[model samples]
Target: MKLINTEEAVGHVLCHDLTQIIKDVKKVTVFKKGHIVKEEDIPVLLSIGKDHLYIWEKQEGMLHENEAAEILYGICKGKYIRPSDVREGKIELIAKEDGLLKIDVEKLHMINSLGEMMIATRHSNFPVKKGDVLAGTRIIPLVIEKKKMDEAVKLAENKALIEIMPFKKKKAGIVTTGNEVFYGRIKDAFGPVIRKKLEEYDVEILGQKILNDDPEAISQAIRNFISEGAELIICTGGMSVDPDDTTPTAIGNVGARIVSYGAPVLPGAMFLLAYCNDEIPILGLPGCVMYAKRTIFDLVLPRIMADDKITQEDLASLGHGGLCLSCNICTFPNCGFGK
Candidate 1:
């Protein structure tokens, strides 16, 4: 460590005390290019008790150690932007004297509302530094009034549907139980219908189990499937208050915590969710899920498969545009059902 003044020192150094005063210190060098940043590296940086740090010219514009750490965490878990390809499009580019870039796309598919963006080079082989201009994107246009776009350049922000991709590849577990389908009676149409819905999301079934109207056995099946490593568990059959309807009861019996019992949604009002210890999610879908064009499942499934934990507020937000009437052509991305 090189100490230039009484205030602070640079290079890697550890201190057990915090009363130390460090002033006018420009930068610290804890890491360099080619070093992968992890969440564990945060406290080490913060131990210096400094809010910001600078890197060499070659290391500029790289996500801050903490921010890069978070992005890497998501990427390692397969919950991230698809790195297979970079999708780009031309928009009207407007650069301000302050060096902020405004981007406009046909539509933004976002999990959280756009607040800010981390711009970096899309190339996997090329190196990016702290001040290096990656792709410039700002959220100001999306949140501000119409005048905002007028003052900014129109540029498309090439975005990857991180949540949708995993959903498309996810192997699912389906549990269906109902006296109507268990006995030699009406066809077991729900399974095929639900399968079709999963097809739209490109979800594949890893396993399917059928049970009588027994909550205990149905719950056990859910546990069994989860133990077998089902990322998504979908339970169908009984989602209503009918005496025989037991799917909801079964899901709760399996020691899973419910997100909501009944939604303010039509068609699929009896939707239920439970998070296992590992955060693997289980859903008790209402019968309307099997037939309705737009149900609570349609609203919640995408977010859930994206690994987003739905909250009461998130569900409440959907009430503004909860109903989805079947149409000749579904304009989903444009529709605000789950936006």
Candidate 2:
């Protein structure tokens, strides 16, 4: 690129965007790339403190900032994501639809490790809305070495480093187990709470059953739902170690593979997770979920809807950000309840 004083730059084509920023007011591009500078434009350029300008001059084995940013965008673009037009030496990746965001962190780190380039993305394996900015890529300088960008492309290896998995609508079955609720001594509140949460994801409740504290009865109800084409099963109440609590044992008796019977999260520590036939998932929720605004269930439900299997290690990792502050105005998911 050729650098010339603004006084001598009239009639020269701009090699990059000229940005003007006003504190707390606005930031705008005064001269676009390839813009032919006119005598009248010199005052505007000088107002923005640009005494010198870079005019496009191609050099072998070097890349301009916009060119480098396009290469960076190619490395991270994947299914269900769209790239925005390059602007100000940067490109943004936006979600094409509302879905779950997934990032290959290892590859992402490798790409960022290469000097003169960067990729910043939202937390992976979380829900994202349509039009949300999932990631952004840019060249750190006005120009970069072609070799450096080539290294980033080699790390990406022509594969997508980021993707969004669309959530699938699934039929759900709920089993509410508690003697007091079954006998009508107290109203059954678990079913309604489960229904409300499921509704957020457009899940259809196939059926619900309120059973006494009988492990056999709970097990039978689970099998019945599966036979009725229920893709997801939720068993609430009776998950604790009390004498009457038998939801966990009942889930096992139904031949479901229990991924975890407990979690490290507060307000939902007694949570249980199991999969039947390695296809259908069964959750044993404790009583706390009925009252708590957010719990471990909020963390796992999205993955389940996306058909992403949750492993034992996945549940174990929740301990890091499991505790909820239970603020007076709970802003869960936005707050750090299950980050």
Whose TM-score is greatest here? 2
lDDT of 2: 0.91
Give the per-residue Cα lDDT of candidate 2 at 9: 90
lDDT of 2 by residue, 17-65 (tens): 9899999999998889889999999999999999988998899999999
TM-score, every prediction: 0.53, 0.96
Question: Each prediction's Cα lDDT score?
Answer: 0.53, 0.91
lDDT of 1 by residue, 246-317 (tens): 888788888887877877776666778778774878888887766666678766765665465777676665
Q: Give the TM-score of candidate 2.
A: 0.96
The candidate that wins on lDDT is 2
Off by over 4 Å in 2: none
